[model samples]
Target chain A: MADASYPDGLLYHPEHDWAQIDGETATFGITWFAQDALGEVVFFDPPQVGVQVTQGESYAEVESVKAVSDVIAPLSGEIVEVNADLADAPERINDDPYGEGWMVKVKLADAGEQQGLMDAAAYQAQLG
Target chain B: MVAAPSDTLRRTALFDRHVAAGARLVPFAGWEMPVQYAGVRAEHLAVRARAGVFDVSHMGEVETRGPGALAFLQRMLSNDVSQIAVGGAQYSVLCREDGGVLDDLFTYRLADDRFLTVTNAANHAKDLAWLRAHADGFDVQLADRLDDYAMLAVQGPAARELLAPLADGPLPARFHTAELTVAGVPALVCGTGYTGEDGVELLCAPAGAPAIWDAVLAAGVVPAGLAARDTLRLEACFHLYGNDLMESRGPIEAGLGWCCKEATGFVGAEAVAAARAAGPAERLVPFAFTGPGIPRQGNAVVGGGEVTSGTLSPCLGVGVGMAYVPAERAVVATEIEIDVRGKVRPAVVADKPLYRKAA
Candidate 1:
């Protein structure tokens, strides 16, 4: 698993999700804190493309050998793409949570929802 | 889920070692215990392919002694007490009058007139109280040995080799026990383990645990916790007390009839014999998922039955567990569907001991 890091470029949610914002679309994945607590990821059940997700609501699920957890939506959007590779290798969520482990590509439903999310520094501060 | 305050929980003698090893401690059976260290899958596979040591001090013990020990135990435990020779170990279920399983136990006969029975941590107080209540006519003496010993299980393919060097005498063989000085500490080394691996379980003074733990670790035995133990025992199809063998379930349905000798006339013998003669309505069987999704305890079977214990078998790389299903549908390879939360999962009844070493 990747070392604990909340990169400055990503916006974080209180639920431990991160959004790599890029204009109207952003890639979504769980933060390092989330994966580390859940242990090794064994299964990733992704949300379907074209489905709408509301901020602060669960959109998908991830499972470890011992537990199953909800993947909360950090910002409201319609899922444009899902990480198909994760169906075979879910441990990517732990290995590189920000890069290859991204769960979905979301086209923002309301770009204004970004204001409610925390910056990387603010997220790390809240963790303490 | 909210856990009870940590102050109310008990700690084993090896608590410090677990914390130093960076284990994830959680509350279990009124004790704060290490659920995992490093990771569950890693620790589980280590025991299967190599060796791992576990601090099982949370389990309680009862010492039965005096001239009437044999007769007293024969009346209490389901197994025939006459079959156990001195220095032998035997397994049996503590049952209620109605054939319900009170707890499963392993009794070691240290001498012709003395024996030690180990009880599951959660059921210790209840088991002890029950035994004391039933001791009216028996002349045997019972001692609660919960705080008198700290237990450690060293298990796996290479477990013996690791302990052999530290022991002053030869380690006991399977189903046997010996008083040995291991790692400069006096311990009763019993050749028995729940992980279905070749191993020894040591019972020693609580203060002596650290030395033995360190010696075993230095000999290359990885530290394992309750999570790995659960997974390993499940893969072996062993009945876990709370999950598989409950007070409402009889030995016949739990597939433990072999350990019960009807002629012994133990507390629940009559009911158990009746269950055997008439047959059980529901039987516990091991099953494996054919595809994605893992099953969990409390998950309902599609037709009838319930999942009591479930986990992803590290060796088989699939979701496997035991469920109580109707007798008609308990045959091996029978198709079954489990409702995991809301989604339904497809599985098939499989053979016991889901993982086996190649001969």
Candidate 2:
């Protein structure tokens, strides 16, 4: 988690979130940069599965021992599923931010929004 | 990562060491300080279980000497200054004439006529000015020793054992101090710590701090940061100056009446005595969440109070915090509710030191 990394085929938001687009459905989670900056995630308060999320807005919260940070939504969507495993083991957000740490599965409101997000290369460049 | 402007912020003598250790530095009390190194929970547990060393050089120091030193301190500090023997340490609060707290300090009596008081970094300049303004007729000489020394606190159950090998002589006992050579440098070793653990605080010259810090770390003491320090102290129910004890509040209301001796007639003694006689309406007490939510500073209490300090206690594995609630509701086992952000969380007022060491 010390080194910064961004995987290919994933879209990145300036707020340090990643979206894996799959047809009308997408998975969202915070990036390694976000988790590393948050220091160990001790608690993850997820939003309800039916909740609506708007781009560039906070939909959930993650708390460390010393601070609490809002988990920003990268795209507008209606959450179809929430990661229930994070309730007991939130450190997975730091251990595997992309795969096991996926926060919510959403049905995209507008698939066109994906064109606005940056690719892995562009996101890594912005981090510099 | 978002970065603060570092040009205006001060750096301690161990700034380079913190950077080398990959600490996540943040702005604290106008200084670029490490909030965490490995992690807050890990560092906090390290101190509670084994040993952890902290770079507390951001804390300031003041030296008071001369014939009227004791008398001057008696008027300024809440405790009975005359009672502190040489080579002893005492904790007291500095108060305004109106009884509002100014700062909490720990004074070490280095000699019959000389004493050194450690000040909170945020209130150091204000404390120095207040002391100097009140020194009109006293024969005391006050010197700001902020830049002269760097402080390191080695804390935990094994703190003494880990530090003893590096000391030229025996370590100081609780509430005591000794002049010893540590890591080949002359240092003032004091048996005092903010964490609820047996530990010693070392004060060494700024130039010699790195050597001593490296030596202590090499001895297997985990390097902790300010974030861990706060969690540990809060779990121990120690009052933080800005959060728990503010200038708008008196020491009595903060549950620090035990340290304020009215017979000493220190500044604000009359108001403190009056408050004691009448009893403060609200008293600060430690509380822990009975459920899931973590309370935060400025969180509203359900009825009529506010949480001043809050954190997820690593040792207790639950949310613990201190709040100023009505005196009638401050008893242990009293059920309370904390408005964490929006949702209300059930809590119970507990005794001091929310976390206790296992026997």
- Judged by TM-score, which candidate is best? 2
Question: If scored against the real structure, what TM-score would every candidate get?
Answer: 0.97, 0.98
Position A13, candidate 1: lDDT: 97
Q: Residue A87 deviation, candidate 2, in Å?
A: 1.1
- Residue-wise C-alpha lDDT for candidate 2, range B165-225, written one tens digit per residue: 9999999999999999999999999999999999999999989999999999999999999
Write the residue-wise lDDT of candidate 2 on A10-126 in tens digits. Answer: 999999999999999899999998998788888888999889999999999998887799988889999999999998888889999998999999999998888889999999998
**Candidate 2 wrong stretches, greater than 4 Å:** none
- State in Å the error of residue B42, model 1: 1.5
Residue B233 in candidate 2, Cα distance off native in Å: 0.5
* Positional deviation of residue B349's Cα in model 1 after best superposition, in angstroms: 0.2
Docking class of 1: medium
Supply DockQ values for each candidate: 0.50, 0.62
- Candidate 2: residue B239 lDDT (0-100): 96
Assign candidate 2 its CAPRI class.
medium
